[model samples]
Target chain A: MEITAIITALCLVLGSLLGITGGIGVYRLPDFFTRLHACGITDSACAFLILSGLMFQTGTSLETVKLLFILIFLLITSPTSTHALAKAALNSGETPLMEQQQTQQKREER
Target chain B: MLEAIYGASCLAILAVMGLALLRAVLGPSAFDRLMAVNMFGTKTVLLISVFGFLTGRPDFLDIALIYALVNFLGTIAVLRFFEGRKTPACYDEPAEEQKE
Candidate 1:
């Protein structure tokens, strides 16, 4: 019983932390690619952790199946969407600072 | 114990949703807003699943799945629209700057 309570508290604390960290990442990250690092972690990993705790409390049911699908969808789409966003950003000339510097240098040489 | 655990997840999920909403409000760029909207949709799926589990409703998962697909499609469409244009398309800015 005590173990269950401890686990519950842990999930609560950890989920909040993940949520807050992701928010900060969204706000603090300078670019779209960097933002993906934050949002992707929140979607792929943090959601899984939170969902697992919820699953434990849910007992065995079809709800589990749904959660499974949610996980699967998240795993597939989170990265795919991030990749799409990243590719579009790159195609539009959004590069990391170092790469931007390299491009600038190459431009000066021409 | 079950209620408490599921409740916590719901609350945390809401917080994440709120964060996404904030991004939607203060996106600084069309892409950031789009990311924020996508984040909101994914968070919504989790929210529905947790709520269904809390209430012992199996049918909700189907709705959640549909929601996930719609969210994915919506995001892809928005991204493609922006991609088709030479700019971020929504913000009318050059270079698609986000944050400082």
Candidate 2:
């Protein structure tokens, strides 16, 4: 019981910290792609951590089963949506900042 | 002790949600807002689950699942809406040519 508690605490705190950091990144990042990466990291890592912690707290039960389902669904959907969003942006001709910077650098070199 | 942890986690989630809200409001483009909203939805799932545990009712997990499904579908639908507008020429041109 004690060990589980300790682990749960660790997971919750670390996960939420990652989440907050991701939120800040989303707010501060200069472009859509960078912000998407930040959001992806938080969506996967933080969700895994928090859900796992909750799983530990719940022990063997139907709730734990539900948590696991949520985790799996999140893992699958978050990345797919991120990809779709990026693709849509690309289709719309939104050049990423990094690509623009590289082109500018090459022009300067020339 | 567990209660305190859950409480702190809830507070942290709330702060993160606030940041997401800021992004949603200040996003320069529709895609940016969409991404922010998607992220916000993910955070909401976590918040709801944490709250459920805090309140000693794990049934909220089901609601989180429902939210998760809706968020995914919502993003897809909105993105489709955006895409449809982008290339309406191809979608509408053939019909117009036939009409003429």
Evaluate every candidate with DockQ and list the scores.
Answer: 0.48, 0.48
What is the lDDT for A75 in model 2? 89
Per-prediction TM-score, please?
A: 0.79, 0.90
Residue A8's lDDT within candidate 2 is 94
Off by over 4 Å in 1: A2-13, A97-110, B55-59, B94-100
Clashing pairs in 2: none
Clashing pairs in 1: none
**Candidate 2 ranges beyond 4 A from true positions:** B87-100
**lDDT by residue for model 1 (A39-105), tens:** 8777766667666655565457776677677777777887888788878877766676568779899
lDDT digits (tens) for residues A2-104 of candidate 2: 9999999999999999999999999999988999899988879999999999899988989988999999999899899999998988897777999999999
Report how far residue A73 has shifted in candidate 1, in Å: 1.5
State residue B78's C-alpha deviation in candidate 1, in Å: 1.7
